[model samples]
Target: MGNTLKSVYDAKDNLKDYHVRAALQEDKGKGTTLMSWGLQDFTEKGDHYISVISGLVVRYGKGNSQIDETYIVKLSAPQVTKALRDMVAQGNKKEILFYRELLPAMNSELKKVGLNPLLTPQCLYANQDSENSVLILRDLCSRNFRKFPGKSCLDISHTRLILQELARFHSSSLLLKAAQGPQFVAKYDFLDKEWYNVTEDAIAFFITLFDGNIENGVAILKVLEGDKRTIRWLQTIKHNVYKILEEMMKERHSLHHCVARGLSGYDEYGNPIEAILLDFQIVRRASLVTDLHLLLNISVSGTDRKNNLENFLQLYYSSFKQVFDAAGLQVPFQFHELFQEYENKIMFGTLWALAVIPMIVSGGEPSEWASSHHRAASEEATGKQRESIDSKISSKHGELRARFLPIFDELIDQGIIH
Candidate 1:
């Protein structure tokens, strides 16, 4: 162990004494975190990292624009009252295993990749003594990310950036698993059928919430509710939706109709200088591309332009190229091959957009799903901060559409959709 830095502050105060000496990255106030999102089963809505059971609040801060010298962490009271261990004890093994194995193991891997351990701050802390397991994170802003915080139509450039990052992150993990073999295997247990059962239920709940453009909305709903349908065409919906999710829970795993062309070249610095990953809560043995597709669709739904789709693919291909080369592996998969394989996967992204757009797009005002994250974000996201989220989304409407449509068309061209 190394010497700990000393600062006079309460364990739960947001003053200082929060730097992780080993973290390879630091936040300069890059992004914002909201507490609620519809109905999260784990229920982190009103508190940034609340333990529903523990009722103890662990306050952490990060900025993409600042280094450790300005970093802060605090310990505080919980927004809700629940026992952390009590909930853990009642939860199924896979949920527990996610926190116990995958989260910690993935954090360790991020550090190995020479980045901050908590790449996305999903949950990367464990203070067993105080019975407070929370996160102390380096913000996602450190990278030039295009994770359009609020309602973004889909900027081609931003979409591409996200795709590239996913490609890099996914392939990077694949390379690590390839290299580490048993060690990596030992760290992650396969998410079993039970996990899928839980996810299916959660997704079903969201599908019921779709209230968009009526005909389109109904079409989306019909697809979401196609579980028991025996129709042949419905099979396409089932295959595109449920089947993919099932396979994802099991293991490998998009694109659009816009017919996006791979750019001749891209910003080299945009490549994986280092890996920054997301959603450890769902980090099962899956095609990392599936996650990328889901997020991209969720992010850019209804945006007219599809080159954003092409841009997204480029992001994936380029980021992946960078990481594979750095890992000293000959980049084996061509970008087009991976794109073709993932074409249908884009529907998941659209599905996500259906659910998330209503909640996050407006920026400051409360939407249908606001209560989910609003109560939780009070600890970190102020009203002013939330208002600013709109600005991030507002400035990019044209660009987002320009970039998003091509991705959609590309998916259609690949014959990934019926």
Candidate 2:
């Protein structure tokens, strides 16, 4: 092998111990002799930028036959800046902590209540090395898990499955807190801060990023000839963005769940039958509607969201209530209360759409927003960054308009803005 290829192979070999340990866990008490293993890049372009993801396949012999097991491994990306690397490392640390400690404890509570534990990728092995963190998880692809094919927005079938899973996840938190008391949940309060850590050094970068997103969103609005009043409302949100962000991030509710950053899984007919939530990097104590707002606005199509939002809410509530009822516990909030809270939290949805929809429609890479060292340094650099963002928005102008106009009109119809 060439020097670079040899180094990569050497690194994969070094991870053999973790692969062996994961194999033992999968094999249960049955002794299996390890035969060989291989590693391959597992992530698609634009799927992630923070970490290098690989598939680790290990072969084991049992009698005259052999079986192969696969694991999804994550390692910190080497090409990014130290600040970005540190940020990803922190996220990995939290995910490891969540899977190893908090999730099992919560699952124990679920067991007592006779509800199946929330389905997530099983962590086979993990470490939180500041620079070279590694996380090994059972490959969900073996179970037919995959992201929505292509850049298609989630349809009603897909949204239904996600809502069901999200409801169970949220309800589990409520049950756990009730059984173990707030003190149990309080032990992990540090998670709330880690979700979007804005270190003093990176504050200027985030400010620029946030401001740029809002500007692009407004630009899209004007391009679409969006309501004049709605434009004024968004401008107002931009002016008071910090306070609004703070309020949204505050611990406003008692029940907090493991809100997934994304989900993947599907059945044979190209329809979504099951979904497994991925990435527990931020399990915050926030209103359920906050998470609901994010998922609906970002992943689901605006047409689906506008037409079936109420049905979605009701599905979530019924599913949430079903778990409590099965466990002989009362739901803490009623349907009307959830509906009202969801409306009150409309700005959360608006913010998420503004921040994420443009990127999705434009096929923007994470680095464009994340590589902020230059962008935050001076007025000239900031202007260049804005110009870059404008180019991205314009490249997909038609898609952005189609994706956003429904959301903005829905907000207006609800009297949420304007």
* After superposition, candidate 2 runs with Cα above 4 Å error: 1-36, 61-66, 202-204, 222-232, 254-268, 369-371, 377-383, 414-416
- Candidate 2 lowest-lDDT run of ten: 1-10
In TM-score terms, candidate 2 sits at 0.85
Q: What is the lDDT of candidate 2?
A: 0.67
- Local accuracy of candidate 2 as per-residue lDDT tens digits, 232-297: 887777646656766765745643433324456766776677877776655667888888887887
Q: What lDDT tens digits, residue by residue, belong to model 1 across residues 272-344? A: 3332333232345555556665565555554523435566666677776776565566776787877765564
What are the TM-scores, per candidate, against the unseen true structure? Answer: 0.50, 0.85
Each prediction's RMSD over C-alphas, in Å, is: 12.8, 4.4
For model 1, state the Cα shift of residue 352 in Å.
Answer: 2.5
